[model samples]
Target: DVAFLLLTFFILTTEFKQPDVEDIVTPSSISKSKLTEGDNTMTISVTKDGRYYFSPTNNPSQRVELLEKMGEKYNITFTEQEKTAFQNTQFVGVPVAQLKAFLQLPEDQRKKYKGSIPMDSANTQLVEWVQNNAKINREAKLAVKGDGGASYDKFKVLFEGLRDIEFYKFVLVTTEE
Candidate 1:
């Protein structure tokens, strides 16, 4: 009876982890401290090629609200169905101009999307996102997971943007060596 119960537990608990939207080989750190799983944590994934993706933890309602708030700020509109889809999405990497269409696509198709949110002078979308997200979720703490090979130049603008917005407290997500 015990053996049968153990087998059932193993079968129920085994699960496959999904692949990340972008590949990030985080730099190793001497300190092995783990980041606590805070309720209002937001993560920014940065790839070696300098792309960015954003995700917030565990709250579907907040996720949908973020989409709606961004739409209001950008003068864009999203249908109810699209907002529902965005709420279920694990992370977002596309630009606002393409977000409506991107959200409309099926999950499989969204995984195929390779675009990143713009971070340049002409389109500082990520900065805008961080600011709005902070306002909406006042306790949200940002965790930036940057690839080891990503350039400092790629990070400088984001740092400056955070500084300008007075968002100085952030975590650098890294691997422990």
Candidate 2:
């Protein structure tokens, strides 16, 4: 009974970390540096298929707030349900213009939609997302996680998008080999 009581107490007091945004096979590196977890960090993930996902570490409220702000800027109004869905979403990869439609899909469908956010000169939604988030919180640290099998051109586009907004400093997320 004492062991059971102790286990229950510890479980109740411990904080659980959120799961990773997606299962990615990150490129390996020899660096031993560890990533610092905080509410002010933004992780941008690129999948093997060139899809992109943006997530602010440990801050669901901030994600929802960003969505709301973006909606207002684009003259798109999201329902409470949509806002809640955004909060629950681990990462956002859809364009702002299609966010409403994306949010309306079932969670499973949203997960299955393998579309990448456009980061070209003609379509600058990715740049706008980063710029808006930076405007809201200038101190937010940025990190890019690219899959080992992903193309370099995808990353170049992402870098160019950031450069357009004058954000030149960002970390690359990699695993120790």
Candidate 3:
């Protein structure tokens, strides 16, 4: 009787709340792979235009800024090492650090950091260029699914962007058929 009374009290007093969830759809792939579940893991989508969109694993509604955020967080645009890497290759894209610094600076402050009275419109264009191309389209775990038609070059850029953000384990979405 005593145990039953305690159990009743506990049950009555306890509060239960269901967590909110979002719907995320991933495309299937033929290759075998595993899903990574976590709060930090993110799913990034590489569009045909080379735009990237990503969301955290647990919360799909939370939109990620993708490259600009990464470039800001990792200081990729200002780092000397990234600059050196960019200079070494001709076809290589802009130095990650340069991009980061450009993105990090405020519109008005860019001129001060850039060391000139009149800001270079070209540099400003580059900053806008970075922000314009990246976007988060949907809510889902950063678990990425790609169509077979996804290009290798575009994929490489996506990979580099992921690497820039320090994500090593990615849940590659695929189908059995």
Maximum-lDDT candidate? 1
Candidate 2 ranges beyond 4 A from true positions: 1-17, 57-60
As for candidate 2, its clashing pairs are none
Tens digit per residue, CA lDDT, model 3, 41-135:
44444444343333333322222233434456546433444334322211112333445444344433432232111112222222222222233
Residue 116's lDDT in candidate 1: 89
TM-score of each: 0.89, 0.85, 0.34
The Cα error of candidate 1 at residue 119, in Å, is 1.1
Give the clash total for candidate 1: 0
Instruction: Sort every candidate by TM-score, greatest first.
Output: 1, 2, 3
Residue range 1-177, candidate 1, lDDT tens digits: 999999999999986454677778999999878887455888888889999887765477888788888898789989999988997787789888889999989988888788888886567788778887787788888999899999898898778877877889999988998
Q: What is the C-alpha RMSD of each candidate to the true structure, in Å?
A: 2.1, 2.3, 15.0
Prediction 1 global C-alpha lDDT: 0.83
Alpha carbon deviation, residue 37, candidate 3 (Å): 5.7
Clashes in model 1: which pairs? none
lDDT of each: 0.83, 0.81, 0.40
